[model samples]
Target: MIRHLGLCLLLLAAFWVTPTAKAATVCTATSTPMIFPQAGPTQVDSNAVVTVTCNTFGLSLLATARVRMCLNLDGGSVAPAQIVPRRMQNSFGDPLNFQLYSNPAHTVIWGGSAAPGVPAAVQIDLEYGVPVLGGAGTATTTIYGRVPAQSGLAAGTFTNSFAAANAVLTYRYSEALLATPPWPTSCLAGGNGGASTGFPFTASAPVASRCTISTATDLDFGNVPGAIATNRDQTSAVTFTCTGRTAWNVGLDNGIHAAGTTRRMRLGTSANYVRYELYRDAGHSQRWGTTAGTDTASGTGSGGAQTVTVQGRVPAGQMVPAGTYADTVTVTITY
Candidate 1:
């Protein structure tokens, strides 16, 4: 028993005296999420930063590591092949077109090997000498995003992840103590190798429709003679400018004199009225009323000034009151 005890003690001392291999290196990655702003132009941009950190325990000699990163995107309504023309979906499942790039210049498409035509992965080459125990070094890369011009999309928040969906980021690194390594350009957007985790980011765009209406030019008729010989006609215009392809309607409400849809001009203080009508056509066949898509002037915007001609006429031989004749019509545009 004593001999066995002495042998065990000697083995324990030898194990303590023996040197083991230096601790292996480890790496971690994180990203700053990006948000793209709303715009009418075909292209818009936003940016985010991806950071990689590597740590090495105290070692007498220089230690180096090779790191790589890639994306594992959640499937979207648009196919992976459509990554060049990517689309983000809203809560209602509506899609807004957009894309991600590797540089601020937006020349290169950021993608993964998993996605054809897209880059397979990104690499970070690191090197450091150690006397300090477990020191960390960091490398950062920028990601650019763009939202292309669209016919139309409702205002809301759009994202890559919804429901149980996720946009995963995979990080792979070699064991510490490797020689200086070469950087790879081919594998940037696609996941290459290493451990992975959820990379949470929010992509959003706010849409606000804009339009301007002008009634600066009102229908004005010169002083009427005592006896009307023929119909007195006058022309005025209502001009508007709105965003491209935005559907809008112009409604001219019944004048101050209210007789249902029949338009009229009234005396300043008296109940007496003169019958008049507003028409959209020169022939006065299409009466311009207040009903949308029915009696109203409806059009799809071209992002420019659009004029709607207002033709008015006073029938001859009415023999009505002759102070100052005028009518105030309310023009309302619903977009």
Candidate 2:
């Protein structure tokens, strides 16, 4: 019985001597969200960094460490995956396609790098021994981001939140009993000193200037008296629309039968012509021509459709032309 008790004691002593494995320690981390300026037709790329730091108390105990950072992007909702073509949501629920890359080259994927339980996190692996020294172990990793051509989206600020479900930075680590490798020169004697929260960012773009002009309108004065009789007048209008505050000009070119401001319309299929003139005001003055601001109508756009009228008159008695008279004038708009 004494021998049996001695064997039991030996077993208990062995149990007490054996070292127990402990759970991996998590480090403190802080990150700044990536910001993208106004996007254009070409790809707009940017970068931001997240610093992961470990307290000195447990830094020396960790032999070799492995870390993975993940990005959960919802674009204001839940994302299907973490690959290219990731969308961002606007206040109006509109979506814009964008991408998050693991490296500067954007070759590897950072998909699902969060804690073991979270499935939607996109992750990237950093260099081992990120926190080399025990006192203040800290390391920084770059997040490469890009917003492809999204000219179709309206001009405004677009964003993704990281606090709740959209875009958050998550991390996990594993350690062993062996010694960690030497720290890189960049991270040597450095550590993340501040607190970190979820990473969020903004993507934006400026809408290009746009303008449009309508088709021409015909100005006709039918059946005018021949030998310097009474004056015949007609009116036609052209409509145009443009962005607000845009400066624009409407210039009317010399008609096919014009001779240096002396306007005339030719008889159909005949060399004979009838003299006429186009004016801007009612008094048959202010001749409309190709010169901007002087002969052409100028105005500031109010972001709506506007109409400008063409005044035409056949002055009393232009001799010639016994048949149908016509003229073709080209309208030009410069904005």
User: Which of the numbered candidates is closest to the native, going by highest lDDT?
Assistant: 1
Considering only N, C-alpha and C atoms within 3 Å, which residue pairs clash in candidate 2? 30-196, 110-122, 110-123, 111-122, 111-123, 112-121, 112-122, 113-122, 113-123, 228-317
TM-score of each: 0.57, 0.53
Model 2 agreement with the true structure over 99-126: per-residue lDDT tens digits: 7666688765445433454334444455
The 10-residue segment with the lowest total lDDT in model 2: 187-196
Task: State the number of backbone clashes in model 2.
Answer: 10
In model 2, the Cα lDDT at residue 94 comes to 51
Error of 1 at 154 (Å): 2.9
Top TM-score prediction, candidate number:
1
lDDT of 2 at 104: 84
- Prediction 1 global C-alpha lDDT: 0.64
Candidate 1's C-alpha runs over 4 A off are 1-24, 56-62, 71-82, 114-116, 129-132, 162-166, 176-193, 212-275, 278-335
